[model samples]
Target: MSHRPKVIAGVALAALLAGCGEQAATAPSPAASAAAPTSSAAPSAPATPVAAPDLEADPETVATGLDVPWGLAFLPDGTALLAERDTARVLRVRPGARPEQVLTVPGVEARGEGGLLGLAVSPGYEQDRWVYAYYTAAQDNRIVRFRLDGGGAPEVIFDGIAKAGNHNGGRIAFGPDGMLYAGTGDAARTATSQDRDSPNGKILRLTPDGDPAPGNPVAGSPVYSLGHRNVQGLAWDARGRLFATEFGQNRLDEVNQIDPGANYGWPEVEGTGGGSDYKDPLVTWPTDQASPSGAAIVGDTMYVAGLRGERLWAVPLGGGAPRAHFTGEYGRLRTVEVAPDGALWLTTSNTDGRGDLREGDDRVLRFPAG
Candidate 1:
């Protein structure tokens, strides 16, 4: 499909399976190897802002044998924390090292495509010592905050998001404005995408304390934007341009450059041609080629992980056609994040009940972004 000036489209498909496999071996964390900070939530070294990124180098193996690694985040000291979709465990990962269990969230019900999903450290972590999470609970999808040590029960800052076997849009991050942002699915209720009153199928903005952001479109509501099918990936460029990757139902998928209070037509319009009522996507791909999930941006380039497509996509900002990377070389790519050392990190999702599992079924890879 031609991905030129077209508009479009997060999560779908999976089953209730026990996340298997034991934790990988451990190594001293970056902090333990250096000066440990008071909080493990410090932001990683900012990815170098450049005019372009180079991804030609072969990727290096970071770690292997993970149980559906879904959410990937970095700390100021360059170590990583990841969330397993089925295991409900957060792990500490390092380069050429093994993953060690950090803490398992309590009451996480690992339903289809649900469970412990997205992870983000506080923008003010050094002071707040808080790490935020979005996950599937017994009753609904919710967001909570807690420290790594299990210091206290996770404070339920937000709740009542509809849950389902699939389409549980579960990606969360802190925007440049230091406000918490979440992409939610319609929970298979197609009509909710166009409903402003429902949080489903919307990108929501809130204070870290779980209140509606001060400048939300509604005076006291959390709906930053509505009409998304299932948003699974969120990232921002150097200019603070927020972009999201969404899962389309059958025909099209999208990478949208987000605007405040904008409507991304879903259920109403799949790809483009929504007219003035909805904002079109910056790029669109056939569903077969881009079930785009986790997204990370470096310089002027965006890297999106493709789950069913089994590849990584490099999308350039200046009217450049997106190029594919490692197509089918890594099966079912699930998560992508820019590491503190300025490398692109990707996680494979072979063990996520869909792909043909390899010897090292689920793994993480690092590629140069310089």
Candidate 2:
């Protein structure tokens, strides 16, 4: 199957915005999608997985006037640090205030889905005041850290990953275990994804200092897993199990339980190959409906931000049938984060050159999360 651009999602919703240009009404329930998988495909049956929480309340617009916001991370003080992909600017937003530009990164390439992407506050942020970012540079994709005060230059902690016009993974987060985890795309090079020596197309585990984490899948190698086309989201459940959302080539999109040293077939097989060596996705969706981006886990449920699909997905931690919400209601969902106040914060990506732009082309929305 060829990769067709599913442009209907974001464009259709632009005409439905309120007078203030916000999505004020509750979205209709999603139609049953055949792409959703059942529990039988999961790694294991979860023991008493938590039920889905309520998000029935109308989502509130938290911030507006964003230019293709791509990443969201909250501070201890409840301020949101947002990243704009093409702008290479990080904005700090309060719950009821406009977003303020806090930091601007230098040397960003910002071309074709590659730019200043994922942002993560250091685990010891209160003391260290460090905020990490994954972005595309002129030569390769890299990760850098900067202080919150904006006084000093960005410290390049990691670099030399391959770069291209597309498929630059660019999602970074500090794991529960205190290691920095990064998801990288294949740079449109299929061979690089399968190459252990190449950093592209792999989930990387690193120390705060950018060295490979101890006890990694391979000695002295930063790669924690291999064989990915474009892994844009990474989250951890209460049990510290890692989950990731992947963009497939043409046929499928995936949510996989990531394991150390595991190989998820890319350029070889997709969806389910029934191979023991390659791990299968816990859930697979049609490529048109689920170009999943960012993910967050709250309690025993995981929420994925769907881009092409234009929806939010709730999946059980123990692996089961997934549910969809706000389908086509908020066009081109970019990032979904569990906010400090226990709300689900999401950003729209209609302004990212792929969707129809409205009066408020991109905005931050808050949904009640139990």
TM-scores for all candidates: the values are 0.86, 0.85
RMSD of 1: 12.8
Q: Return the clash pairs for model 1, or none.
A: 7-281, 10-230, 10-246, 10-247, 43-76
lDDT of 2 at 63: 90
In the range 81-162, model 1's lDDT, one tens digit per residue, is: 9999999999999986789998999989997899999999897887888888999998889898999776888888888788
Q: Candidate 2 residues 1-370, lDDT tens each?
A: 1111111222322222111111101121122111222212112222222334467988788898889999899898888899999999999987777888988899888999999999999979999998989999998999989987866889888888888999999999988778889999999999887776788898888888788777665556777777899999998766566789999988888887776766777878777763655666777888788799999888767799999999998876544567899898879999988876677888999998888776776999887654
Please state every model's RMSD to the true fold in angstroms.
Answer: 12.8, 12.1
lDDT of 1 at 342: 77
